[model samples]
Target: MYGLMINELKNVLVAFICTWGLQLLTGITVRNPLTLLYFALFWILGRCKKNEKYDDKKGKMADILWGAASIILSGSVTFFIGRKAVLGFDSGLFRLVGILIIFAGMFLVFVRLKDLPSLIKNIFSKDYSFLAVKGMMQEEKSRKELPFSDLKVLGISAVICFLCYLPYFLYEYPGIMTADSLVQYEQIIGVTPWSNHHPVAHTLVISFFYKLGLAVTGDINKAISFYTVAQMIFMSLCCGAVVLRVKRIVGGIVAPVLSLIFFALVPFNAVFAVTLWKDVPFAGIVMLTGCLLVDMAQKDRGVWSDLIMLFVLLVLLSLFRSNGWYAFLLCIPFMLYFYRDNLIKIAVMVAASVLAVIIIKGPVMTSAGVIQPDFTESLSLPLQQVARVLVNDRALSDEDMELITDVIDTTYIHELYAPDFADNIKELVRAGHPEVIENNKGTYLGLWLTLFAKYPADYIKAWFDLVGGYVYTDFPYDVGNVDGIMANDHGLVPTPLIGGKAVIKGKEILIKLGSFVPIYGMLWCAGAYTWLVIFALIAVLKNGRNKKLAVIMILQAAMIATLLVAAPVIDFRYEYAVVMLMPLTVSICVIIKSEKTAKEY
Candidate 1:
């Protein structure tokens, strides 16, 4: 027990040092560099002692003493550098006390090093192999010859999906209206000019349903009410599609039922459905594409229906989100590799998708009078760096400042630039200097590259602040607020179609509960994304029979890569597709094991 405690203590110290050391590198915080350096030395010496052939109590004691001395040295260095007493003690006296604490720590380690090697061996030994092997054996014994049909699961889940969604739809009767939805509705009703700033395809779809509602009932409110109900049904069908795919992978009813409960009761999915965002249907389509991809892989000869679904899904996915098209382009090579045997079909699909993009984005959009998205949206990171450098008053040569001025009004960037987000800076840049950007792409690119070379640290810090939410859990930016996007705004007057103040308050409570509840909160956090990546990697590596699931990872990775470059800010909605798809990815890895995997079990 004594040796085990020491080993655990060492592990904790290593983790602490690594965590803070990384923060220091990311510019999240500042730390005494010497402290990190000494901890690294301590870890090294401890590992060396562990590998020694014979007991060396004296050497272990000496090593602990060295670590203690290094800590005291670091404290003295901190005092000299800052010329401030640590915790009210003089620098000299602080080092003296710190040295004493280190010595006490050393003595504890000296006492425990006798059995340290054996304790560590016991901790990391291969004894757990039997557990894995035994579990596999039991699974093999219990394995069914044929899996149950997924039809019942799908039917039950769809009913649950609708029933679970009813309360939210009722509470926010017409809809959980958002600013984006309002803008889209206004465009449809001729209150504002139609533009393709949001996807033209989604807007056209909304216009069709909304107009149908208006024609049938003659009341715009009733139209909205009908539209909301229609959205709920569409989203419920999406939930059913996901359940069907999951059922196939897991080969059981329990997992699908649990998934149904997760979707049925989880406030986020309900809120997502009720709130109309381009990302909502985009997420649905992405999942459908994944299901089709899996289905194609399961077949020896690819089905024509499956090929048609992929082609249509790729087109819809591209139109819904601007980056969707790019993500599809990135995934194509992998898709072809996965379907190497069906090259002709895959080739035709790609050629057709390319042609569709040209026609839809060019002539079709031109006829519809939808303006193309601004080019600056694709340049979020560079703009962030420029604004941050201007804010920090970082060293910029006179010529460099001139080049930047040609691209943006540098004077107002300091006032408008948000330190941890890129949206405000983006607006400032695009609005302030439209003419220069419209004409001078090469010059701006050159200036950006030169400034990056000059203030590399500021550049890195700026980017980390923007996109660090994906990798760092404690990233200070709050990008997951669905309230603004889902606020119950239904014109100036209150009506039955409008969600009243009480319903809005209830929605707020649900959001908080979804964020703080034990398992539920995981769905809302950036930390969950880190685990999703880890699990996806495990699935890709472990499930040899179904390596096609790695396509999901490929698509997810493409999205993340796009986020690094194009995300206006680290908003959770931007990565929602990845988060919502995790269950299926993990199920494919763990439950859909190959016959060889079953033998090992």
Candidate 2:
């Protein structure tokens, strides 16, 4: 392992040398150094373990050359296949195919095509044995099943979870809220137009509870309070369900007890439970789904009931967030492979989920008069390009200026152009510009390309500035106290909530501790999540059952990649799903590893 680590560092050093060598030759400074570091880190984490196994067999030079070749091949393939999508895909078909190709190529290289036959044979074997698949199966079978279900563990854990958030619930009574709630609530109250932008599925949930509250008590505020309580109940139950499942697998009261504290008492998570946001409910459901996935990963054979529940959760997951569908897209392929024993069942579920999304988001949403979101949301890179060009004060002819103005109004670019954010520019164009961006995409593409060719460094700088938060640790603290605060200017009734100063101070202190703490800070930053994903990948490559749970890391990687191209800002809420899953994930991995070690003894 030490030798393998040394080789990986040597590969990175070679890449670093070649990087500066190119800069010297071309006199063009690298645009996104973090991006390079990110890719190298990803490569190291994923491939280093495999290198360790092969180190004694392969010569040092062979190891170095192989690593370098792997890096070049992966990068070149991605650049060539994804270039069109980078400019912009005219059809969803192109983007979907491009992503599929990328993942396929990635799997082929990462798994080594030379071993394909053995891998497939192992997967299809009566008891899949590759990466200790059969060992995990044996462990599952050897475990004694309890004669009766223990509802007490569930009850106790749920109560603990509820109590953890009680302080926030009491302090911020009804909820720690935000402006987005009011925007979403307007549609539920029938005072504003309905739209899929806020996701009608979640809006309908709020509306049902609101009307239910009114029918019972005739007080709207009571409904808000009920809604907040309902969120807490749901989250608590989900956390409890996951803990119970873990307890069943590991056969310990202590680990389960500690798991409860981690889930219920973690500062950010505890505060997050009472905050009324669409993400809260979405995250709660995601946790429930994760439990189901974890159960499925441990068992040797198929369970029809669990499959049905997983299908339901995946559908709900895709519905609650706009980006949820993308995450699902990245997961389904792996699900097929991981559950290869139940190919037909997995296929049916995936197909049904996809069809449901198409029908609901297309015809159902359209019938309800849900206007499509702005085009600029999808054009983050292009918008950043325009902003960068404007910031440079580049000299342009009248025709060039006119061409740019035809796509985006250049007047607001000066004030709205924040290198680290795309929302300001996106909002400017959505407010004033015409919706001919798709129609005149060629012209827009030409302008973007011309600017890129002219000021590559500036474009690179903008990309890094916007995306560095996810890949680098020092990219400014942007996700501060977004929860536990209400929008004051939106004319919503003033919250009766008081003494929030104390709560705010508490949150600020937690954030600072997370940011500055030496070893513990990995739980806090965007870059830390990147490392978590990397660690999960290493765990997956080392074991196949681990792969079942760790495959979600692919979704994490894809989500982060999407953010690099499309996110408006670096918000912690964006990666909250990862935060919620990390503890449970580590616990499961540790338990399984301990079991394996005991068996070895």
Candidate 3:
């Protein structure tokens, strides 16, 4: 009895520490009342029936991994966030204490998990294809017939998305043209040099519409507005297609209705739909590609057109952004594995896509003289790490100083060393003898590796400062407020068509509410979406036989992985693809897994 009481007390204390750590790690106010709720929840979980009789060594690995992830992740965020703090305790020491508490919290979580993993074994083990994705290939009849036809499903969903997006379009007329959009516009007008830095394919797409709009309207702003409206329609159709795909897979009006609500009402979708970013179209194709993968995997053989569509989309996917190509490449193995039943056709399509991408990106771009992005673009992590070492006055060998100064002027570093952003330092490299490191690849690699070994703690903090937002839920990214075009030198700016006090304030209220609203804002949260995807994947792994549903998720996961390694900015738009497909991901995982699947797994 005494032991149990002591254990409970320890659990409560651990819960408080982790709860506070999480609030701080996520940039939440330390004084929020929500900590008490989390503390109570953890205590209740700890007090639940505790037994480990059923779990095996294999399941223990899962617990350990989760615990280790919690410790490391929390520790990382804690260290990075506190780096600039003036607190008396050393930032490193504070991080160590935070990690210790987070570890204890993970212990409580393991206690809550109990022996469920071992119980998962019979726990209803069966043909997983039947159990996991039973709803995928066929449609179950509704208790009452759904009135909507297939075309109606597509049209209805599309119209709803467009209409929902209309307000954003009207609010920020001519579209939200930021720095990248302005650059694209300059390239379109022949004022700036052509470059694949902003994908030629995407630039061409914009060029087509803007030129057409000019011919029709003879007004640059109108042309831009025309492009925005057209983009909204195109993206709406894409989202509608996503909704239709999800509805068919889940079967019924309820799923479609809910999906419509998510696609239409979510501010991220609306804002992104009208935004003049290449990623908007890229995300659309990504979602469609995911849907197609789902369709092909759910059947023995897909329609004949699936191959052609796959080829075309893959080419465009590879062309839309550099990262898109890499992400697709990363998923090829997984795609082959999950959709192996249709191996020959899938392989042919993928090979063709790869060839097409190579041809376009290589000979085609070279012939067109589109300048590729500087090589320094790929060295975001290493650049930030080196800069951190310089900024913090860490001891460095003369050779290290020479190597860094060869690429970056240390004098400018004080002004350039932003903890989270790498662009300034990257520019510094470009400003210096940029090709020095590029030409000496082996030398640079050795320098990066050696520096990492020397400044392991600084390296970790530098990386976490940039990437922790994606892993920490409620990381305070403002998606809804990025409504209007930024000030641009090009003849591009916001020409808002709708603005009375009510309309403007209503939009303000929406954006402001998202900042403080608890669950609602998660629609725009990278970490929330990431965690949700992970949970769905776990569901698939524990219960599902074939991995089609899980395979489709690789689309988002691959893109996100690319971002983690090389993301320049922790912008909401970068992670929007995950948010776009999350509803479908959750729906499929939920439908496939049974009541017993949850109980056992």
lDDT of every predicted structure (CA atoms): 0.67, 0.66, 0.74
Q: Per-residue lDDT tens digits of candidate 3, residues 333-383?
A: 987887787788789989999998888888988998888898989888788
Q: Which parts of model 2 are misplaced by more than 4 Å? A: 1-150, 248-255, 394-401, 478-516, 591-601
Note the clash tally of each candidate.
2, 0, 1
Clashing pairs in 1: 136-601, 137-601
In candidate 3, which residue pairs get closer than 3 Å at backbone N, Cα or C atoms, i.e. clash?
Answer: 128-545
* TM-scores of all predicted structures: 0.75, 0.70, 0.78
The TM-score leader among the candidates is 3
Candidate 3 clash total?
1
Model 2 Cα lDDT, one tens digit per residue, 1-601? 1343365565544334333322222222233234345344334333333423544645667656665665676556556654443234355764565444443344335434333454445447753322333333355445544333568778788998998878767766667667778877788777789876766788888888878877887877667777788888988888888778767756544457767877786666766777767878887777787777877877777787887888788888888887777888878888898778778888888898889888888898888798766666788777887788787898766776787677566776787788877878877777766476777888778878887888888888888888777777655564435554465443434254545577767766665555432233445567677666777667765753556766556656656676777777777777777666665666666665775655654
